[model samples]
Target: MFLQRVANRGIGLGTLLERAARRHPANILVFDHDLDAAPQLGRRATVGEAADAVADLASRLWASGIRAGDRVVVYKSDGFDITLLAWSAARIGAVPVLLSPQLDGATVETLMRRTGRPHLVTDGAKLQQELSEEVFDASQSVLLVTGSHPRARTLGSFAGVERVAPLEMPPDHPTLITHTSGTTGVPKLAVHTGRTLQARFRPQAAVTAPLRGRQVVAIHVSFVHSRLVTALAISLLRGYPVVILADGGTAHVADLFAGLKPTVLEAHPNSYLQWEELADDPRRPLSGVRLYSSTFDAIHPRTVQRLLAASERPAPVFGQLYGQSEIGPSVVRSFSRRRRQDADGRCVGVPFPGMTDVRVVSRNGRPPSAENPGYIEVKSDGRIVTYLGEDERYREQVTDGWWRMGDVGYRTKWGCVHLLDREVDLIDGFGSTLAVEDRLFGRVPQLAEVVVVPGADGRAVPVVCTRGDVPLDRAAWEAAVAGLPPMAEPVQWKQADLPQTATTKIKRLELAKLLAVGAGQEA
Candidate 1:
């Protein structure tokens, strides 16, 4: 709450974190996951300890020639250390660009180049491998290795370096840069000023304030994502114990939750889908969960039903936020056990009354109406300043103050938002692909995940993953799809086989390309 108040005063994002550490020094800030060991838990840091770590790391970065206004690109495996480094860069008034480890080497190179040859911070071994693979450019950039290497200075080697004072900047000064999930094409870096980033956290604190210090908040979203940073800030400021999980595998999640029994859980929608079986686990790992939060994409109705049913806590609720990387949470809706069945899979509810404004506009510029679904646009305080190196592209999406969301949806008569599909992914014959997928989910009880993409012939193609290894029942599948546009034979994929963005949304464009190449020939 103090952080929220400070954010309202337009404080810098880096300074706000420092204030949180001072306010709640001894509170447990994070439970980081150990990626090297499958079952072992990673390290934990208190607010004071985390703050000190970040300050020390910031000194080290300064010693390594990073100065105010410089850009430092962080490309490392998931862990709390990445977070510390990012904050450290911000503290020194440098912009930190975080790249997901899930990104391919070529994409990484493209992002690094786009950042104007920013300094690279990554594992030494990984850097070498990338260089050998011809994906890294060492000629124009400086490298700051996180691990041992003869060619680069390691993070540990900079211990006890001289500390530098945080540079004072206006609230609107750029402090962090993160890329879009790039589901459609090359990822564009979304630039966030302290003002924009702080605006995001203020709303979160307001929503969760009542449960402050009473909940053990567990997060399993992408480490490089903006959500992680905001969540960490909220937990530290509110004195809630925080747990961070690096992997979203069902077994890993079960193992982690079995011991923690977190009261609040937040993750990507697909991560929740992967862990849906945990709802029925004998240990009842999710039984203590009081709140479940999902963002970035729409979640399935059946998944929400099962998860809420799994929780034994009285008045348990599932909070869904529909948003994008460029803008923070635009719309939010909550589901309780009583209302779970009433939720439409595509209805993302209404925009936050004062924080966001949403409009559905037709291609020819007609006003939005319930009868006519069109492109969705949003004007929000949390919108990013600009896409790094893509100013013109970013400008193209904005008209007046509203940003084109590239989504096809309409507002309901009740003032709720019903999302149909991404503009690029809309298939003509089947109407809304998401609506059809939701119908299939209701009929096919064993379905785990389903994505409808356009086929080479321009018809809807349903690509799905069934729960566990149980084979699909052909008769049931056929019956479920009876009236839909004639589909390409349903392609069955392992959940992990589907290409995904950092936030766990299937990369529809890439997945469609794989299907075109006959990746799922058996279907």
Candidate 2:
């Protein structure tokens, strides 16, 4: 209703590119890799060509028996096609359930079962490698996005299928379904309707209003994320040339940015952490950036300062938003060049004025404070209606109009929200493991990743990964932890060895369990 009342139309992913083409037919989209679904289209295309590709893909999906109200699960290899396939599926009024390529075969099978045996879109590489034959057992039918399989028909098989007109569904129709990060266990599907998604779009889009003309927007966000829907919508509709990356390796990104010189960029916080090295590159990959937006929560202060410094703009702003898939962008904060390098990373900004609100509820009888952080709860029109197959589970997280963020934090006197730790991740004697890690990040520049979790012996352990896989200097480590709460001698591990969610968020519990078996223990 928010979007309809303002724009007189609802947010429909299926027709997004088509609408964009109407406004700016020649707007360009550049990709770091070829799209698996439309590899023939090459690495770049005009908005009009992209619209035609989506329409053609929609017809093929319709020919494959995917219809309005049907559920189609996309579990293909990692590529931008994952995002475009979502659009094509929605164009035909089929709900797209996107699972990350990082998920193993067992996890994919589990999710497919949860999706009511939906038709699966995947590729040959997955079928031969990560996905076991069990996926076919759980899926209604297998349709390949690229490579072929004896059990699945390839999208190329339906090439000449007549284009189908985009179907118009009600504003409340389920537009997309994306999974939770699954840090704790099996991920749950979060369902989003058009109107709810558009509510998220408004506040985020409003922030970009002051920018004159068009700007090239480069993004390295996960392909399956709900944020991509709104992000692509905002950029494309505004006639901005776009750059999308499938890989987040620093070398690849450095080359791309150096050559293309995008003005606006958005990426996951961890990706931003990785990109900090690009600041010192001779090519000045990040110099042209005017706005740095981290579409994830609680980025380290050091990473923020490093990236802002890389931008040669007179006044660059780093935008950080705190939220999860269940509730879209609950709160936002921005950092300018004038801010201190050691700004408090825990103080994740305030809620959106009218579109979002937050209240900290005490777990104990005492008032919520830094020492006794309370449960972070939020109210947003953008909150999902339900978990795909777990309505009761979704209901349990909501009280009145507020949804629990499952994080413990307190609001400052100035109304700044200070995130302390995940409620489930809290340690018995530790004040805030996250805060300690934040401090270590700022003090020791060598740390690429630092996670403080409970060791098997019940002592707080700091697991660290250094940039370039170099060993951390012993003296610097000691000096950094001098004033902090006591922790075990640091355990060094390769960043790849640490368990991570699809979004690159470290799985603290999984790492602790693995540590119980001497996994990733470096002397």
Candidate 3:
């Protein structure tokens, strides 16, 4: 089978850095923020130094009684060390359950309870500010990455602890656990094995195979995401020097990219949206970038057009991978500098032949089309084994080995998938809310974000955030929405006020609730 042919065995996350060091010990890693676990090591380190830090941290975790087959939950403040801590936990054969820093205290407690009293690894700010004191009570034992806690011992306290050999587990053993985007409700824990993760890496790595040796690959994925693990691994193992961003602020990114001039860039779609203004920067921060890559959601064509126009490289391309946390990237679509600005943003792209398959099932007993969309189902070796502690819930998504993506879309005659709206977010008679949003983005240059959600009255409502919170030009909006599906007057809100996932995807359902009550949401 193609799956087994691509990667017959699992890739080890624990010794990833160590393995990379063997081939490229001097490969440099630049960081914007200092690592909390190894502050003395500073913000920069070589592959060799990074490997040593992971090994050192693993010893500390072992000395603290984290053994093979155990689960360790890392819920510290935002830092690259969150990923390094995951590596360290895996080094000792303990499964790493990563929680996003964006998750609220109540949500964390719910996840901790779901993990069934797993050992918690966190920091001072979370303990004092965000998390409840009961977190300690819900954990098997709490370990601190930073700050003091009487109930927890600092990870650094075990600095001089004896080091142990890295334990290797079978390919099917649960390697990592990451949560979903939590757009609707509490996020579910997605359990991943080494084999499944490596399957995901294979397709993504193939995307970068065309690049030449030693391109400066800068990554800005969330620290706790499973994609970060494979993104780092692919770069490190391939000997590409890396630049990791802890902050996605425009000024910080401009200053850094002006100096380093990365060749390849990877970030979430919304992050790219946030950096659209960087195109006009005098320094041409994206000048040297050859490829712009994003995964997990559909990107706006307007955002793609602006970014590609900013790139000075010959034949720059924007690659979008449309999939979910439960299933790794199922389809890919790439946009080039020459592509028209009105390119169909809904056509997410085609599946990888032999490796991944996609099918849209009919909903109304008719062939699915733009008028009547259907459920998007996909099959891939990269699919997560199950939702941790929610086996039945996971089973509900799988039917005869195919995973339902919980998205409604139709396939084009050329085989491209047109993602319309999420299953739960669909509005009756409002043909494709996403297509409407895409058209709005293309029509309104001043708009930063526009989400179409159903109001309590079942009318489509557009929630808009202007670029700089500037007052929306009412005339421009009126002209933009002309001849389109009818919607309530645009509700203007500050971008920060919008409920977003860790990946920066706006929560449309949550936004709808806020607008349903007519709480003066208009700007």
TM, every model: 0.93, 0.98, 0.98
TM-score of model 2 (CA atoms): 0.98
lDDT of 2: 0.89
- Candidate 1 is scored at a TM of 0.93
Task: Name the regions of candidate 1 deviating beyond 4 angstroms.
Answer: 1-11, 15-17, 30-32, 35-42, 132-141, 340-342, 364-372
lDDT digits (tens) for residues 1-523 of candidate 3: 3344654478799999999999988898999999888786687899899888899999999999889999999998999999999999999999999999999889999999999989999999998988888998898899998899888888988988888899998989999999999999999999999999988888888888888866999999999888898888889999999999989988899999999999899999888988999999999999988899998799999999999999898899899899889999899988898777688889999997777889999998999999999999999989999998899999999998799999999999999999999999989888988889889998999998888888889998888989989999988999999989888888888888889999888888888888877743664
Q: Mind giving the per-residue lDDT tens digits that candidate 1 earns over 1-523?
A: 1122333534365555678777876667556454321112237766666667677778888888888898888887666667777888888898889998878777888887778868778876567666443333532344544556555666667777887887766778887899998888899999988788878876666667667347888998887889887777777677778887776789888988888899999899888877889987999999999889987777888788889999989888888888888988888888888765435788897877667778888865776543456999988878898999899999999998898998988887788889988989977756788878878887888888889998888877888888874677778999999887678788888876889888888899898888888886444
- Which residue pairs clash in candidate 3? none
Q: Give candidate 1's whole-model lDDT.
A: 0.78
Could you give the candidate ranking by lDDT, starting with the highest? 3, 2, 1
Q: Cα RMSDs of all predictions?
A: 3.3, 1.7, 1.2
* 125: Cα error in model 2, Å: 1.1
In the predicted model 1, the residue pairs found to clash are none
**Backbone clash total, candidate 2:** 0
Best by TM-score: 3
lDDT of each prediction vs. the true structure?
0.78, 0.89, 0.90
Output the number of the lDDT-best candidate. 3
